[model samples]
Target: MSQTIAVLDFGSQYTQVIARRIRECNIYSRIFPYSVTAAELRKANVSGIILSGGPSSVLTKGSPRPDKKIFQLGVPVLGICYGLQLMGKLLGGDVAKSDRREYGRGRLTIKKKGRLLKGLPKSIKVWNSHGDKVTALPEGFEPIAGTENSDYAVIEDATRNFYGLQFHPEVVHSERGDDIIKNFLVGVCKCKQDWKMSNYVDQAIQDIRDQVGDSRVILGLSGGVDSSVAAALIHRAIGDQLTCVFVDNGLLRLRERDRVEQVFRDHFHVDLRVAKSGKRFLKALKGVTDPERKRKIIGKIFVDVFEDTVKKIGDVDFLAQGTLYPDVIESVAIDGNPAALIKSHHNVGGLPKRMKLKLLEPFRELFKDEVRALGKELGLPDEMIWRHPFPGPGLGVRVMGEIKKSYLDTLREADAILLEEMKRTGYYSKVWQAFCVFLPVQTVGVMGDERTYDYVIALRVVESVDAMTADWAHIPHDILQIISNRIINEVKGVNRVVLDISSKPPSTIEWE
Candidate 1:
């Protein structure tokens, strides 16, 4: 943690990806607003600065721009996309809208093996998503690489240790992206690779102890990686001072309550209280069909029920959640830029309002994979650590249209079958999320010579590094056939099963 790389966010969706890439190199990194001053960065003791790409055009007036003094900070500065254009504009160079905008894959031909492009090939594939390009290089700047459309795709001022790229190297679609980032971190910035998950664990435990001195903490343990790890870490820091509440909301998957009870209560010996409030949640959710309405209803009811349970459990000082960085970034607009709010996280800002308790979120700065690693480091079993992410609204969102007792039962059974077959076929751990979305529409089918109309289940299985982007997982036809057959026959769900073959852009992983 001694040497840090600071990423300046300009409302880019891939801003977190840049931070994640730096962390993957065992170098600590943090994100700041585009308005962060050089004095602030100097106080942060940043070894290098990375300007993130955004959906902004540098040619537009009032577009997002960083403090001009950052160029004088003397740290190695790497600008990307809009960042690159911003640099060219601010540093006495010309930036204009490209006649041929590069939005997808492009080839970068290295003109010089500068320190920023050290060890890279003469030509490499890159992922581009920019409309503006640097037309003229600033003083003391030279082009190190060029794409077919962008003559100054990569520009560098070696004297000032400033570099720019018109393409994003943090995305996986870019070949050798990690190497380019590594070159910047180790080759140019000279960052010490000393950060580790073990260091984070030790630091987090001590931080929890410091933050909650002699105060009892209450955690809503959903048995997911984030909460589970938070519980384990907090419990390790202050034994018996943590009380975990697992609410059976009638919308969870098959036997989720039992699994949670066994793992936390029986195995881990956590102070877990199960509030058998399934009927209450179901009643509140009855006749609700809109996804947003379902989420809000469930969140409000959960907070109400959770607060009631807390009243019975005695006085609590703090409320803990397993909120990760994506949730934080998505909820809050980056410096009031045009990132736009995606959705409010149920575990983030909801409970704190009604409960009126101090919030404790240890994983707020962490990513999903980082939380899983922390869970594993904290001695959580592989099954729980690698569990596919479940929506905060639980199966409430998964059961698409209305909330009904019979629909819940049917969806739960069908989802369980899908998971069972996935595990059997070794596809469970292979995908990021695998679930069944219960479609309210019924279809005609012939079952045992009887014409019947029943519910249809849409199977969504996606592969993703981060939930920001995902592609449908390509399970073999044979395995899919087995899953479809099992769900149709073993589970009493109505007739048909369909696979979602769409990617993330046009279609989301969830139907609703």
Candidate 2:
């Protein structure tokens, strides 16, 4: 509610990570485009400014650049990666293409004791991802730190509180990254450590009421934490004005439709409607095999069905979705940059044709954990709030390659067995995602000296603080053995089970 830091997004994938880190320190932060001017930032009462790293070169034509007047805003400015090069170019410092690009984890040695790096060690490892380096500094600037190949890795102007780092200090892979952000946020900007997820409830409720006014809102509740929490918030703000539509596409996990409907319709007193269109969805996806094609088909189909449902609901003013911050950052490219496509958001990219109703997404700025915290603040059950996330396409993406009713049936059964065993072994809550992917292939197996050939199921389980990055969960060997045995023996179609041991960078949590 008070003064918040402004993080300028120049098409960086890790821009949200920087904002998340600042919030972790109990300091409020918001993200903006690189085109935001100093007048706009000042109007928002920004206490400090952070320039996020981007996949761009300062020398490239049409690359994103911040307003020139930002340096004169009388606030602390920290530049990272491409942000450093941009500052070096505009402030009369020299930057050049490095013969050897520095990437991944590296070390930074302090060259001078500056206020930004005040309490840090003489040398610390940091994450670097840049092809260009600052060769010289501007007037009144001093070199603060350096890595082996990077001579001017860190530069600072103590007088005006301007600092730049060639490495990304917002990532967890960077050693002492949190300390660096804390020093800049608290030490330099004088921000109060008062931001809390619980405090967002009242503010968000007031905002929703002001925005929605007397208009009717329709939300597509997928029973996921983000959507359920978002629906609860909007319902609280406008009691009888919000109607929910839960669509069962015949691709969800076991008993998902019944449980979600009971929770929202019966318990929360929400005006909920169920659309029985599983047969249509399955027929549309009968022969589709490509991943992106499958997603587009689902997106287009969902919008069509959702629009039809809204037509029956009569006179709706807005379409509400439970979209989180990650969905926002990944779906749309920041300033139209390439390599920004992680995946397409169903609600965002799924839109078809022109519509009269406005779109509303209250949870677009919050992360997954923050949404859960808000759900708790709204008195949601612990089991519902702590459930693992499900994708928009449901089991369509999980069933690799072709789409078939038999494949869906096998995947659903194996997935249920996997979940049951994980819950029994007490590892369900410890893992971020646990599911079964239908590998459309067969393997030969021995069952009491008899040869058996059937479909193979790959189980994916990972541990992560957030879904942005994750590592394969290391469950106890005995528990895993039990899971594999149950999934293979109990599930009729699945004759073999394999566990995915890859991390986030190399392999995404979902097999597709």
Candidate 3:
């Protein structure tokens, strides 16, 4: 087995982020409950252990902590934020509530360039989000770096191969954050960078084969990257044992169904079944203005279509989905550690239990980029692999408020035009996600020689390393003008186009 870096979750929201950072360094990392015993860590042969930051303070009576025996395991250990305070308290140091809580950027002044702070700069900025600080070091520990508010910003026990950081280096806001993590993972832990996408691909195939010996697997194929990639990988593994059911809910992007058919059916020669249920979905969504209701209607229609399709194809043993790690991480409530559930996702939504089929999520532990890499290894086309994320409700959410066939048709055309212009100007790949929204209210405008009233289109484009947070993309005025002009002239929709310049916290990427 390959050596692993075990990140013990203390309910920090960035726990998954830390795991991703480790994976980006070509090192395998897995998140475990904070209560994971030392024997379990030894059994897994972890090269290093990372204690994630949490909301609770170590001074609290019922705060989470790891096994005391972990210190004796002899592997390199790094604690972050709340983890740092816990480390101090457990190791015979003083940890108290800070007079001034450091919740944002702080300048780190390096006192000693230790292995954890193994760089040339004397000062660097780091993101700090902590309410408590380590006031005094343990017997064998020394302060390697400090910020203005906290004297022990970075502490290390060189004799024990243990380190702690008051700031969060897992986040992108911290300068040279990746380098800091690399130092701990590579230098201190001595982890060989053997983790790669190719290795995952080979292992996933064998695991799939082993799990699904003679069982038939049915996957609900959404043309989006995740499901498409999942379908491709499952097909590559089981060959004729997989059947992909593509449901056309009449709310997808322009030519999305055709693209799925061409890629999975024509190119890969997999068993593809296309369910043309556009009318069913549009009928069910008629006059539904509430976003939640629209989602419910779409989801119900999808399940109906999927069940009907699967019934005709006969019984399948397993239902496969392209559930990535982000989805799983969002819903992880690890042992009362106060990790919030960012969102709830059931890729197929209770279908496995209702239909009595085993759930097969091969990419459940993999991230989005990793899935794309896996897709590439499975020989999927670039367009499919690099496609932006699409909401489960599809264009249903893009057409804000009311659900009408005319609205969907207009939205699809406008969105297609927007994407075409984005790709033409080489802006599609530059931005994380770019799509157009169809406003429910119509605006009056003069077209050619006549006055007309039509719907308005809103363009939403953002730049982000992860969809957790996003900033509006500053596409050049020329490209925006081109996209706006094309939507108005080519698509039989609104004459007016507007840009959304709001960031993620204040506004979401999708209008609905």
Candidate 4:
């Protein structure tokens, strides 16, 4: 069925931000490629269309463009930044490179009011990241708003229900962004608030069945929300054909082993294999301290372990992954924009050339929150579904220096205590990520009137919507005191405890 709003992505970093803002207005929104047709959007029952901004210029050779048929669908269409330029250029308007590009917050003044901009501030801050601007308005379109840098900042044609903006209102930094989106969703398009997470389950199951008909599949069960939910959906589709391999890299949290076996092996009853390769992984990572090298080593080991397991189960046709949109954006190029590579997430799987298993990742189009909602629809336990984000490298990347069994043990216990205290003080769910980092440096401390030196453990916690940006979470003093005291007294080979007050810009959550 059609949605209340359909956003066609042209590889913008803020594409997800647009979908999120619409949801904040209590309306349903889904994203599709710029190649999506008006027929597809109509089949989805879309009431409105949004063109997301991208890094590419409309004048660039072979840049992405929306389907020509979308414009003729006669729905209320809103365009942003590059989106605005694309619409105007395609519909008999002139577009060119601006001599002075607007790249940050600027003032937007209303030249005329429309239903979309109604009840909005006459002047408000808006974010801009575009080098190209519409030089001439499209036929039948008139200017509705403008900034100092661009004359036709916002244009609209009420007769055709077309609107365009030179700035992004989806960004949180944009003033009155929420109200602007509300006016578009509720006042302009009149979308009904009728999307439920649970409504997606049955459709997903049917799609899975159609894709994996009688074919054997191997799933990499990471115990994270994405993989677990993907496994559940595939299990429902192919039944006994799915085999999940769980490798214990010795970098996992306290009792992580028990939890994996209990949940997947015992409860879900999917074919689960637990490869106890902790000793081998530790030995391989003994002298590696560079963060990039550590991630590469772990990723290689994971593939090797998984490849070996797949050989044991002969003739698997597909390798199922839980790849998300964030993962893809960081790892690979899309829409001709070669993104800088981020961490080598172990979940990003490419089997050896010798192993010929096709990739099957159903969650590739979704973000983390959408995956969590799917987890809920699959009837996953709250604790398993809502667990704080864990890195694929486990504690291997958490430790500051070279990996060691001793360091792994100490870090695990300290992190467990941190988790416990967080839950006790009701901070576990409040913070995005809270964990212990084993600093390589040691400080002198007095114990029982004797001076001693041992490794220091730092507690780092932060809150963020997406892990891209974050701020230091201000933990309560009492809870901090209790956590610090317990770690020092209980965890051995540790003398002092410290708190990390640095945010993401200055410091990442991990020590390594």
Candidate 5:
């Protein structure tokens, strides 16, 4: 078994990404809050501890602080960003408000050679996002690295197995960041990288068996990869004790409903209950024009429909969902209150409160790509494993204005053609997410000297590590032209096509 590391989150937006990096090193990891007790940490048998950066400044009154007993655990501890400042303040150091706040990329120079900086270059570019800087070093800790603005950049307390870095190494902009984390896990903590997808599958099977025993579990399959993999894992664990309930909200793509039922029933040999609630969902979303309201309505209806299905299928003790790490991080509020909901994350926020079933989220710590890797490890089909992420509300939110079957069908056909052409050109695997959004506006266009007015379709493709920030994928002009021509000629009701060039901060992935 691989050694387990516990990452204590301070409500940072990048907490999940930090855990993902550790898993990428082939090591098992879990995330907890700063308020987690030392006894709880001991129960996990954590070989090492990591403190995640938070959005709050350490000098503030209401800022989160870790359990002081964590340092007494006598295990290796690494802190990043705000975590570094917290360690400094708790251990006889000074952290003052910075006159110059660093929000993006910067260079750091390593002054001393230590185990953490062993394989890294002398000067490395790193991602920094912090308002305060460590002005003084804690006692028994030496500064290993520093930037021109901050002298106490990287501090290490070898005696206590404590390390802290001012820069965020979990992000990709910090190129050698993974190596730095590996040096701490392997060299400093001496942990073996034995964790893999197969190990996760075996452990998850056992975990499910132990938790459920003979109890029944009802999982909601969304036809997306996450829920599909979750259902398969649960079925493998307890066999007939698992029953899958799939709800068709009428917002899915063309033939998605049939494909979902066929894949689960025929290929996986799992018990599936298909509920067609298209009319109910469309009825609830009749005249709702607000984007957030549309999402909430769809989410509420999904829960109600799911609960009704569960009642019909005997008694179920658990509800299994495919809630990934990004979902959690994005939904987490910066205020450090677990009860405080951010956006209505249909899986994490909406269902748990309304339904009485116990939650079972196996992929809570895994990122989107990591979940796909686990899906492949379990022998899932390529189409299911590599499918682009569709939101819980589906294209209902993407339509922008009203709910209509005709418009949705047209959008789905255009999207299918776009994906097919991208796959043929070998660009499907390269982009993070690519899809078609049906615009509420229409324009006049000529198809052989005949003027016609039809709906305009917008294409969006973005590349991002986490959904927090993204850049528009630079698709080839030839490919874009082909996609545009095909949508205009093949898919009816769409006269003009346009590509979205906006990034994430200024624009969301979906038009809504």
Candidate 6:
């Protein structure tokens, strides 16, 4: 097993973020449900323990809680938000629904010096999202930190190696959150900061080898980073035992199908099977103008094709996927709190129920950037690592109204021109994601004496940490003008160009 820090998840949306932050500090961490027993955790060789925040109040019945034996494990424990409340309740402390609730940004003032707050300022900003607060400290525990609203903001039992924080230090808003976590891991837990992408690659390959001993695994290669990285990791483990299926759904970017096939079969030397099912995908998608319907149809059809290919290959016992962290996080509502359902990722949402093969998701815990790091470690080209995020439905979603080859071709050319100019101007690497949407509406424009009614194209670029939220990238007007002029002149059927100013909450990264 990999050297790991186990996070007992209480269904907090930010649980994964906490794990990601620990990994960012060069420590390997995995998340388990709060119901996980001490024996199960011990079997995983947990070097440290973290109790993640949850949506439910600790006072509520049936709310998740960790096993009592966790405290007696002689391992370091850190709790955040609801995890802190649960710790307080279990350790003979008082927890109550705060009359004055604290959410968003708050100040955490360190009242007493402790290892968890060492190397930090006397007071620091922290991100908070809790309705309840610890009213009283547990026996043998002292309050190390507090905010104006929360007296028991942070509590610790140095003798027991347990630390609890009322606010979230995992998020970016918590200025010194990472520093606090680092201090706890090194100073208190004595955990070595040895985790890295290279280490992960080595360990993942070994894990895959051990799990699939002589069993064949077939993976669907979507040419996106997730599937590509997953396929590469499996290939590194089992070599010829792994067969990659790259299905051409006809909705990919211009010439992406060929590029994907060549990259895997020729460039990477991975065993690859290319199935051109563009006609079938388009056929299932014919006359589907509704965005959600288009996505569902495409998802269903892709699964059908992939499952058929797996059966044809025969002897496949495992189905591998490039399912990433955000894909998992957005699917389920954390802590029983309602979270907006973002677009259903094809690989994640399109899985066939009761498949004959078991599932293998190596990148399930990795964020997008971390996946890119693993890709680089696996020797994938820089172009693949830096490629823009593409929706699983592909150009089917880029075109707003109907599915047609002509519309897809036009959008493809315009998008290519936009990307080419961004790369040429050295701005491609600066922007997190940049793409073009083919608007269904057409506008009249005059060229010399002739009037033409054609499609309008909208360009979007955003800067974001996770695709969960984003800000519109501020490209210079001169750059935008160049892209707009080039698209209108070079790409036929597009007469007007517009820039998307909305951010993620109001508008998703993709137009659909």
> Each prediction's Cα lDDT score?
0.87, 0.86, 0.85, 0.83, 0.85, 0.85
Could you list the CA RMSD of all candidates, in the order they appear?
A: 2.7, 1.8, 3.0, 2.9, 2.3, 2.4
User: What's model 6's TM-score?
Assistant: 0.93
Structural similarity to truth (TM-score) of each candidate: 0.90, 0.96, 0.89, 0.89, 0.94, 0.93
Candidate number with greatest lDDT: 1
| Model 5 spans > 4 angstroms off | 332-343, 350-354, 464-470
Candidate achieving higher TM-score, 5 or 6: 5
- Candidate 1's C-alpha runs over 4 A off are 59-62, 209-215, 310-317, 328-338, 349-355
lDDT of 6 by residue, 1-512 (tens): 45689988787778889998888888888878788889988888888899988778888987877899988887989989998998999999899999988989999888887888888989899999999999988888999889989878999999898889999988888988899988877888788887777888888899899889999998888788878888888988998999998888888888898888778778778878888999998888878898878878887887788788987888888888887777766664433333346556666643566566777889877788888888988888888888877877889889997888888899999999999999999899998899999888989998778999998999989998877678999999999999999999999888899999999767778877
Best by TM-score: 2
| Tens digits of per-residue lDDT for model 5, 105-194 | 889999986888888889999999999988888899999998867887898998888999999999888869999999888988899988
The backbone clash count of each candidate, in order, is 0, 0, 0, 3, 0, 0
Off by over 4 Å in 6: 1-3, 333-340, 505-507
How well is each residue in 1-512 modelled by candidate 2, as lDDT tens digits? 66789999887888888998998998778888888989999998899999989988998888888999999999999998988888888999888899899989889999786667878889999999999988888888888889987988888888988889899999888989899889888888889999987767887898798888999999888898888888889999998999999989888888889898889977789999999898989999888888888887887777778789988999988889887777766675634443367777676643544656677888766778888888999999898899898998899999999889899898898899888888887899988889999998998887778888989999899998767888999988998888889888888867898889999887777776
Model 2: lDDT of residue 8: 90
Would you list the clashing residue pairs of candidate 4? 1-44, 2-44, 2-45
Error of 1 at 151 (Å): 2.9
**Tens digit of per-residue lDDT, candidate 3, span 1-512:** 57799999888878888998998899888878899999999998999999999988898998888898998999999999988888899989999899999998999999998888887489999999998999889899999889999989999999899999999999988998899999999999999988987877877888899999999999889888899888878888899999999888888888888888877777778788999998999888887897767766776677678778878999688888887666555553534546766544536335535667788888766767778888898888899888888887898888888788888889888888888888888889988899988887778999879998888899999997666678999999988988898889888868899999999766767776
Q: How do the residues 268-379 of candidate 4 rate in per-residue lDDT, one tens digit apiece?
A: 9999988889987888898988988898898888878878888888878888988877666655455444334555566664666777787788876667777788888888
* Least well predicted 10-residue stretch by lDDT in candidate 6: 331-340
TM-score head-to-head 4 vs 5, winner? 5
